[model samples]
Target: MEKTFLELISENQSILFKICNVYFREKVDKEDYHQELIIQLWKAFPDFKNTAKFSTWMYRVCINAAIDILRKDKKEIKKLVFQKSTYIIYLIMGLSPLEIRKDCLN
Candidate 1:
């Protein structure tokens, strides 16, 4: 069972990288995020019952893990920036909500 799960993951590994790329830009950061997502997928593997397709399950797991990471990183960024001022955060990166989501998702 574990072997089968690893096989499925190998074939659809891009799903993991896509999520990681969106959440992290640097190569080191992306690799770290990829490892974390793989861990998340493995932890959730036992509960999977095939109600959904493997890719679908992988997508959900990857997205949820990435979102969780993004949230944590955002909070950290907020903390660091909070010391400076809200004005810099908003002004320095004037990306729209839609633009930000599109950039990440793509």
Candidate 2:
């Protein structure tokens, strides 16, 4: 069971990271979110009957955890949004102008 959970985590680690990135702006906050996610996943794994794709189940769990965290830290929502916007701008700046224009159109 431990090995199975480890394999699932290895395969979906990026999903958890992406969720953390989306929900928490500060590096420290993101790390906290990641740790929280790992703990939640560890606790929830035993009940997972494999009724669906593990990634799908994991994503649902991640989103729920993120939302719960946000609700608990309501005052930080604005800060998180601003930071996420800044990150997006930075990501766009790193892209080629052509890519940026394409992204804008989409």
Q: Which candidate has the top score in TM-score?
A: 1
C-alpha local distance difference test of each model: 0.85, 0.87
In model 1, the worst 10-residue window by lDDT is: 83-92
Q: Encode model 1's per-residue lDDT on 39-104: one tens digit a residue.
A: 999999999988889999999988998889889999999887885564455446996666655755
For candidate 2, lDDT tens digit of each residue in 12-106?
89999999888899999999889999889889888787789999999998899889888879868777898678557957679765675676578
Model 2 is weakest, by summed lDDT over 10 consecutive residues, at 96-105
Overall local distance difference test of candidate 2: 0.87
> Model 2: residues >4 Å from true position, as ranges?
75-106
**Model 1 regions more than 4 Å off:** 83-106
Q: Listing every candidate in turn, what is its Cα RMSD in Å to the true structure after a full C-alpha superposition? A: 12.1, 14.3
Enumerate residue pairs that collide in model 2: none
